[model samples]
Target: MAKKPLSAWPWENLGSFKYAMYGPLAANVMYSWIYEDSYKHPWCVHILIICALRGFMHQLWNSYNNMLFLGNCRIKQQGVEFKQIDNEWDWDNFILLQGLLATMACLMFPSMDDEFPIWNTKGFITLMLLHVMVSEPLYYWMHRFFHGRYLFTHYHSLHHSSSVPHPFTAGHATFLEHLILSMVIGIPIMGSILMGSGSTSMIYGYVLGFDFMRCMGHSNVEVIHGAIFNKLPFLRYLIYTPTYHSLHHSDMGTNFCLFMPLFDAMWNTLNRNSWQLHNKITSNSGENGRVPDFVFLAHIVDVMSAMHIPFVNRSFASIPFSTRMFLLPFWPVTLMILLMMWAWSKTFLHTFYNLQGRLYQTWVVPRFGFQYFLPFAADGINKKIEEAILKADRMGVKVISLAALNKNEALNGGGTMFVNKHPQLKVRVCHGNTLTAAVIVNEILKDVKEVFLTGSTSKLGRAIALYLCRRRIRVLMLTSSTERFQKIQKEAPADTQNYLVHVTKYQAAQNCKTWIAGKWITPWEQSWAPSGTHFHQFVVPPILASRRDCTYGDLAAMRLPEDVEGLGSCEYKLERGVVHACHAGGAVHQLEGWPHHEIGPIDVDRIDLVWEAALKHGFRPVFQP
Candidate 1:
């Protein structure tokens, strides 16, 4: 039987031989399955079933691999080793599974209409085509937005982490990401079905074909379209080849079409250049592979260097206004040159500073002798402290204590009373404000084997105790202040609760009594005292009896002469002291009795000398390191 072409066809090309054959080839299959009583099962029902089955299989495969697969698979047939390729444990997969199930449910138990009428087949087919046309562009824009910086890090980052994407990576994404993509694709299909003018079967066919195409596009297999189709002027416009879609996955932000290149062409996102590049490279190499590491590194370095320039800085002050106006015409070219020069300068300087040994020796070594000296001092101090603790214990010394003075009090309260402490035992009295206290506690615990804290425990103390316990250090809290000690005990984690032992007033008194009677204790305050009358009074008899290997006398001898004078005066004043200076005539007049303010000119070097002396006496440096 000969079938006549419909006279109402919109385009004459549509009735041509190629269209006549392919159109019916698809149409006949849809019609028989849709209209025949034996095949009356709703097209929507079959689609829902297939989608569910595929989603279930995907989940099952992922679950099995995550739970059971323990080793890498070297596929002999493919001559490749797959490393860490399992996807069953991803959050994306879960969201995808849920979205698919929800979509199927929506299609099956549609809010309206149980069965679609058969009489409106043409209208239904038209609606289905329109739905696809509308949906593809929405997907393109939404997908592009997802790849943008703000959203990409939070949502799209997970997807691109898998550079060589597999089937499981397809639907594996966040719920919000999945929902956005699904609504963009699904709303059109639902809207068409509800309009009641289209063939539901045609819509179902489009959905099935679309899903299969997506899977094949992400598949490992290569299926090039026939050369004749590529050469045919009209047919090329009507269909998408595998090469068309593969380019989309390879080159991001390009080739955003699904079924046809109509929208992609209109939007200028088709990426024909990328396709050409891919074809040229693949033809030569016989493989489509990942980009090399060196190429990626070069791009990163170029980007970083470009971003490093201080664009607002004025190297432009010398140029005349008329010249600047004239240069505005070639501003883009000029700016690019300037930016490139800036990037090169920054890169060269950074590389030389970090990588060139001679530059480091000549520029850095002599200027910062403290950098080399401080580390050696720290290592030596740590070793001597450890040996001292052991020796003190062998001599029957029951307690060895270390103390650091608060920097704030060290300078302001009085002269730095404990400035010359033991050499081997490192002590610094900074104004031990909360921040400094925290830093010191953390640093101190790193070298010590055990720490026994005795004080009215505060939040800072409790925090220090907790941190020490986590590092597996044993801490015994001894304090007469029961409330603060109890707070410390309560805040500690359950596992570390036992490491904190609270000592009562009676217990502390008893321990001190026994140590004093036996002359076996070394108090931290006495151990860290300066070699002056101020700290000599506080040094307990038992501390002196212990016969320490290192003493404050050693530090006092090593001290700068100017520092000793400042300490003597600071200790003489029990209360806070101040040194005042006033300018008179052409010189500065110094006053040291009490606080007073006077305005006058001062000798700059005299002020500098006094400031240096203040710093030696434990005043904080006003400048940054």
Candidate 2:
């Protein structure tokens, strides 16, 4: 397994401390302002500023952890280019709606004044405490409702989309979920205003405290309870630690109570044994046993399948994209069309021989050539990568790795390698890339698990390795080749380290055959060649076939403009099953040769061979295409 380099500063700890210290400071300032003027506006302003500042700082910390630490951590455990499926819902819209509603509610409320009834000292404290009480149960109940079979599919599903939650992911939810949830906080404040039960100052304090506590609960950092507090059973009831909150995210049913566990304990819902239960479930099934795939599939069918009716069903065939826009005004139809076209042009057409030839001749090539190298250069393990690794692990597959030597080294002997000493399971480091290294990996991993490819290697090795990976064979890469190694590491998924085994080596026959034996089975149940350059060529058919299947429909659906308004007479058409820009404005050109050609079947054998080689060496392979 590989360790990803840290990319962000440690801001979460600092922000927490700053909030703790500055909160009292701001409160004191508010007290002084209120006393001097006997006016409530200044106090209200101070409270808002302090709360806003704390929220901002808290988010900054969260962003760093979610985007950098957690993101990298997941990649190290998983592979690059992975996606997770938890539930079906739109969390982003949910969060946005909640934010909008909260903002509106705040705006609707009147400002605090000296004569405000809630401004008195006792009233202020009570309001703050009540806010906590109300918010906890409200959120808990709403969350539980979302888990319900009926509502889970339509409303609560979005939050679960991110099985492993990130910071920004915290608020991503559906609009309906947000609307209902926001009212829990909003209604209380609104009622206080309507009844004039206390001073506006008191109400404002409660809101501030409510927000601060929510942020604290959601923070990923672990905060151990004080020894004294832990020892005193009753005191422990009052303090909710970070670990307590994190459990709620991981396990669905337990830890519903927020701020205080008293309510949950009274109802026998307090998940005091949640940690043990979580461990038990994970050990038993290797996944949280909340929802099954069939259940998720059903939900997807119910929601997205219905969506397909708008296209596949005859009732919708006559409706053009423009007409559909009017009917579904909320959807950004124009933007979606434009984005789809743009993506198609970049992904498929740009790689098609005839299209590339036409595009290059039209001067589009020079402008975009620099962008082509960006994915290679800026490539590092990201969230998607981690998702890939986890997805593989869930399928009960094991990843094997190989490290390639530096470019300066000769392929046959100059390049060094490393191999995993252990055959299967756990993280280990090896030192070089060579035939001996490959032998070491084969010996270690023999009869242990699957294989994966990683590292800068021959196109043949890569093609073979990729095929294996796609077929659920665990193939990965590792490299000691300085620049190439770093690139591979960077391109690895966030969760790679947790699942992938790093090895060093190069020999395909002796190491691979001995280890594979009868255990090796191709995805399609076909035998693959283990020797010769033809093995490399064998990998290509699968790659091209799979890519063609994956992208053909998307390419065919693209709607291009017949002519550009400003650009001189040029017409666009699909020629020989490829997009071409022809002479209204420029010279017509045909592709002379294949564009970005790949050779070989990329089957299980190739992946097994390359992966064994990588693990023998200390490095992993670059999993990205």
Best by lDDT: 1
lDDT of 1 by residue, 474-558 (tens): 6655466768777667766788777766754323332221110111234553343223211111111113423243322100001
Tens digits of per-residue lDDT for model 2, 273-340: 64443234334432322111100000011111222211122122112211233245524553454346
In Å, residue 89's CA in model 2 sits off its true spot by 11
lDDT of each: 0.36, 0.34
Off by over 4 Å in 1: 1-48, 56-84, 88-113, 117-120, 198-200, 226-229, 233-250, 277-625
Off by over 4 Å in 2: 1-58, 61-95, 106-123, 191-221, 225-229, 245-251, 275-625
